[model samples]
Target: MATIKDVAQRAQVSTASVSRVLSGDARTSAEMRERVLTAARELRFRPNAVARSLRSTGTRTIGLVVSDLLNPFFTELTRAVEDAARAAGYAVIVGNADESPEQQDHYVRILLGRQVDGLIVVPTVETSPLLHEAAASDHNIVLVDRRAVGVDAPIALADGATAIDELVDHLVATGRRRPAILAGPDLAGSSRERLAAFRAAVARCGLDLPESRVIHGDFRAGSGHDALAALLTGDDAPDAVFVANGPMALGALQHLAEAGGRAPRVPEDLALAVFDDMPWFSLLRPTLTAIQQPTAALGERALSMLLARIRGEDVPDERLECRLVLRESTEPRSAR
Candidate 1:
């Protein structure tokens, strides 16, 4: 393998000079630096990142922990984060927690063991203590999507309340009085915020959201399908259903298709609205109406925030607004 000594000998410079040039230490003359770099490149030399990290005390690696990789929303978000991290000359290590607190804790320990320079996490409920401990130990940790209970790290989240309010308002304007909700697990911070906003919107519109109308599901397509099926088959089926995220919305659509005679027609027998718009949604039958959170932008921002924190900069928590996109599935009742 090509080593610094080989490159230095080839470039007629000392090993120390070659090291300075490779590290970009700014002490080597420009002409000598160029010659060393050319010699290294010609020899196909690669720096040992592990050795360099040991010397600099920085791995230039960021660890990302997500609740579920199966969800399309999270998949896209991860892509954005990885792309941005790579562009910034950092490596990313990803872990999926499957929405389990124990799994999340396990991943945290593993990442710390790897000596990752920083962390970005989509926290599960009851994981605050672990996060707190990391923070206390001076680890650079940033919360993404959900904030843990006791940790004060910078957070990047969607404006859940505003998104819910907009969805409810759209449903009301389109003549959906009895709107049901498929909420995510109550322990999740995003789910709680969305549900709270939904309830407040229902009350503000003078509509009684009965306990029977609210169904809880994990933020997955299957859970969404099952929850909507339960709600639709119940004694009082909703005139409209608002799903909290894209996968759930897709699941609800799938269930609607499989229910046969009981299937509620979009914008006719029933209206549908969802949070978190995806690329394929607009092309679906009866096109999905949704509140579009900036998924890629959210991921990019979270990574940027974490990087800033890793660099010892103070970054405040941030929330991005979601835009309501009206589509065929939620046409005005009068138009139908």
Candidate 2:
């Protein structure tokens, strides 16, 4: 087992210098930091993070709870958070809540019990008393990708309103008068925000979005398929559909393909757009249009904000915007 003493000896520096370098103290000279880091790397010296955390009252670890691990958006965000944490000399523990409030709360308690230095959560619901209590008790916490009310923590949100506006405009320009939504569960902040935004945008465009046009799902592929099926079987089916999140969008696409002659063919019979762009979207048969949120940036900024809070710094909530990515699935019927 390599130790700090071995690293200090190899670097020809004092143990204090090595400690300062490892702690990211800006006072350490660049040359000394380089020497210490090189020696540590060469010796494969792993710091006793747990012991240092016990003494300093910090775990040097972050806990992240996301709504759905299977979702590509959340998956990418998780990777980004890990990358950012690693760069800052910290480790991240992830919990997938599977869109269950109970599961999310369980992870929250577990992470808190583990004494993580900070927490970043993509909240499964707007009401989590445990999270609120943790915040009130001065836990270092931040909400990412979703917002939870009554939690005294900074939040990092994406511009859902703008994305919905773009989606509506595209649908209307593509000559789709009737539009529907395959929305996520109502308890989730992201779902509620997107739903409200869609309603407002459609109304602003002088389109009547009846209650029947909106269908709720569990943010899963199966739920998405079911929602799409309901829409297709309806007497007055929509000419365009907006799916919230990527996994659901994929499900809706699959449903459309499998329906054969029973359902409308995309573009020619129906148009579709989705939130959360994926790498494979372009490669799909008809290619899909989507709103692309800065997933990686969201994760990085959320971690940075949580770290700042853990360091006793005050920071404001952050809001990032999504971009509209046009593709064949949303092209005008005439153009396709």
Candidate 3:
């Protein structure tokens, strides 16, 4: 197998020079670094990341554990993180937790075992203690999108407070009296944050949001379908409803279209709004109103913080702001 020695010989340099170049030592001249890298690439000489990490030189990689791959927000987060990580001259190892606490813990353990330099995780609801223990042990952990229940790690998130207020005020001005919410899972911290923001906005706008109007879903399309169906069948159905995510919003639209006699047309029978803005949302018969979070910025900031933490730097939490985009579904465009 090709080794550092082979690369060193190919580059006409000593093994120590090759090591310095491969370890990202800034002292190495750019010409020497290029020569070493070209030789390593030509020889297909791969470094033993574990061995390098044992010597405290790092694997030159970071691990990212996503909350759920199905969520478009997370998909964008992954892309943004990859772009930032690559630009920083590092590799990324990604793990999909599927929004399960057990799966999240398992992936975290695997990533730690792989000896990645640091971790960027989106904590699941009721996450296990291993994560907290790792953070306490100084494993260079950083939370993305939401804070864990007990982990005291640095966090990066997107705040939707102003957008929620704008949505509520817009609804009130448009003559909508009753508004409801199709919320995410009750146990998730992020879900609670969103619910709290919506509730506060409703109260501030002088709108009534009864406990019965809050329907919890599992942040999936199917659960959104069922939740919307329940709300629509209730004795006092809402005149307007807010969906917490893109997939759920699409699912609720499906239920609305197929409810036969109970079906409510967008902005006419029932106005609809959502927290996440997707490209396809604009192409729907009635474009959806949505709040667009700075997902790319959130992901980039999380990685930047994680990298700093890996370098033994203390970092503060970050909260990016979101913007509300009103469209036909909210009667802003007056499509009907």
The weakest ten consecutive residues by lDDT in model 3 span: 12-21
Q: Name model 2 segments beyond 4 Å from true.
A: 1-55
For model 2, give the 10-residue run with minimal summed lDDT. Answer: 12-21
Choose the strongest candidate by lDDT. Answer: 2
Query: Which of 1 and 2 is the better model by TM-score?
Result: 2
> How does each model score on lDDT?
0.84, 0.86, 0.85
Q: Estimate each model's TM-score.
A: 0.82, 0.83, 0.83
Mind sharing the TM-score for model 2? 0.83
User: For residues 104-178, could you state the per-residue lDDT of candidate 2 as single tens digits?
Assistant: 988987787666888899988898987876675567899997788999899988886887798898889889999
lDDT of 2 at 213: 88
Scored against the true structure, residue 54 in model 1 reaches a CA lDDT of 73
Name the runs in model 3 displaced over 4 angstroms: 1-54, 332-335
What is the full ranking by lDDT, best candidate first? 2, 3, 1
Which of the two, 1 or 3, has more lDDT?
A: 3
Error of 3 at 113 (Å): 0.5
Number of the candidate with higher TM-score, 1 or 3: 3
The residue-level lDDT of candidate 3 at 227 comes to: 95
- lDDT against true structure, model 2: 0.86
